[model samples]
Target: MIYIPKMIFHGNPLSFGQYFYDVWGGVSYWFTSALSVAQILLAALFLSQRDRMTFYVGTCTLLSLLGIYLRNTLPSPFPWYYQTGMVSTLLMSLGGVYLRYESRINKLVSKPYVFGIAAFVYLSYVMITNPAHPQGTTPDICMYLWKYLTILCSIICIIALSHLLPQAKWLEYIGKNSLIFYFFSGTMLALFGSITSLLAPDTSYILTLTVTSIALLAATGIN
Candidate 1:
């Protein structure tokens, strides 16, 4: 997966799909993606059972697959709508797992405050060092840390929110069709980008970002 980005940056001629199999220089990205999918499936199976350890392991596996798949699947030129569909599916699945086994998870973590503080601190670090921020110019020491922190925060947030909101019935319903949202995000992003680019080829980044945000909100509403 890392190799794909490297090759793309280095001007590799292969199309996005072909690059997944370009293993002459190293591990084929395609194989990595496949392995990630298999891991997700395994995690889903584990989480579906009543065992807490199995559930934890499986959830991690599924998320790892999602990260890998998202990075590898550029989904550009296609409407951002498609991307949304995919993400929606993933989120919905995770939500379902939470709905079914959150109580068991809370028992295992047993220290919400500790996890919450950790997540907050990590989120702060990420905000401070994000590449988009002025302070982020110091070689991105916190960039990698931020990625891990965000993942941790996401898990903690989900658990905490589940307790507070307990009515994830709606989220669970949405989760059931998360793939549709994922697909929508991609398609919408692509469509919006294409139209905007065509209309404003020299548009500023800020403008593009604003448009993207608006598009995302609209897509969310649609979902």
Candidate 2:
């Protein structure tokens, strides 16, 4: 992420400099890495101290946002939704951890067609309103609300789908082999992009996306 932005977009001169320069070139890398680590810690904490989940989630969330508020954090440019995403992802992480343990909510949401319909309707509503991307100079409260609700809806829909789509063996195969796919995919896509640029830089956006998706799937399928 940091490398692409620096090397490709901003064209940072220090991209090939000393290793320390590469890291010090931007705090975004550190912040992004730290946020990922924070999620891991929060997940472990949530799993261990289920009784105090509310406090843990609230504290983790507030601490993350408080840093931005205190420092007057700036917004990331296009293609990087870190500003609002920083908070939304954490909230979603919390939701995922809570869902793993809370059978009551899962059972409630997993009801046939309820979650499926709810997820569909909510996404439709979002598409209707051209909500401004939240990771901008001015954040909207609705964006936060939207992400919060959407993550829950996604979880519910997944549960609903498990009951509805289990007969699809390919989905099961993909799920079983997901880790290997995740590991090799980044390099495969980067390599594919380089190849594309050399052959044809002005490839259509649709074609680029389609090829990228296909390449990623192909990368995952390899032994």
Best by TM-score: 2
Model 2 bad stretches (over 4 Å): 1-37, 40-51, 64-93, 96-102, 129-139, 167-187, 193-214, 217-223
Query: Clashes in each model (backbone N, CA, C under 3 Å)?
Result: 44, 0
| Residue-wise C-alpha lDDT for candidate 1, range 1-223, written one tens digit per residue | 3454445445667675654335432234333334344445555565667566445545554555554466456634122223323333344455567678878867754576866686687678767766897862533324533554566666776666666766666578657766556545555666677678878888797977977786666666886
Model 1 lowest lDDT segment of ten: 77-86
Q: Scored by Cα lDDT, where does model 2 land?
A: 0.59
Highest lDDT model number = 2
Query: What's the lDDT of the predicted structure labeled candidate 1?
Result: 0.56
Per-residue accuracy of model 2 over 137-162 as CA lDDT, tens digit each: 43654555565567667767776667
Query: Candidate 1, 190: how far from true, in Å?
Result: 2.0
In candidate 1, stretches whose alpha carbon ends up further than 4 angstroms from where it belongs are 1-36, 40-101, 104-112, 127-129, 132-150, 162-173, 196-223
Worst 10 residues of 2 by lDDT: 76-85
